[model samples]
Target: MTLELRCGDVVTGCEGVVSGNTEEEVLTAAAAHAAEAHDLTTIDPATERALVAAIHPV
Candidate 1:
């Protein structure tokens, strides 16, 4: 099964949806997307937890 995450679920107003074969892959892509599109350079532990929690099987 593929893992999926909607950027909007974590970041307000974002319409991006990222999916991957594993959580690591989704996290990596989400990190890149956060930096490139949201100007978010770093993710704190709390936010990281949130990101992980937001991921779901699709």
Candidate 2:
């Protein structure tokens, strides 16, 4: 089962999507991309919750 998450879905005015075999893998890559691309060093609890909630099976 693959999991997908789109940055555009969680963040406003952004267009990015990521997918992986597992949720943890997707979140790790998404976090790194968020830091490098969006300059988000740390994800707060609320944002993390939102990210997780935005994840979908693909």
Candidate 3:
């Protein structure tokens, strides 16, 4: 039960992807990558929801 999320699908002008065995793991890694690579310090509630919604089984 792998899960994946693509930043390009949710964010414009970005091409990042994260995957994990669980949604929480993927989201955690994605957030860290976003902070370091995309300069995002925090993900707003709506954006978090959107990210979750964008997650797909892979």
RMSD of every prediction: 0.7, 0.8, 0.8
Number of clashes in every candidate structure?
Answer: 0, 0, 0
Sorted on TM-score, highest at the top, how do the candidates line up? 1, 2, 3
Alpha-carbon lDDT of model 3: 0.90
Q: Which candidate is the best by lDDT?
A: 1
- Give residue 56's lDDT in candidate 1 (0 to 100): 99
Q: Relative to the unseen true structure, what is the C-alpha lDDT of residue 12 in candidate 2, on a scale of 0 to 100? A: 84
Query: What tens-digit string does per-residue lDDT give for candidate 2 at 1-58?
Result: 9999999998887888889988899899889989988999899999999999999998
- Candidate 1 segments whose C-alpha is farther than 4 A from its true place: none
Candidate 1 residue 26 C-alpha distance from true site, Å: 0.5
Worst 10 residues of 2 by lDDT: 10-19
- After aligning candidate 3 to the native by TM-score, how far in Å is the CA of 43 from where it should be? 0.8
TM-score of each: 0.93, 0.92, 0.91
Per residue, candidate 1 scores C-alpha lDDT tens digits across 2-38 of 9999999998899999899999999999998999998
lDDT per residue (tens digit) for residues 1-58 in model 3: 9899998877887888999999999999889978988899899999999999999998
Q: Name the best candidate (by TM-score).
A: 1
As for lDDT, the candidate ahead, 1 or 3, is 1
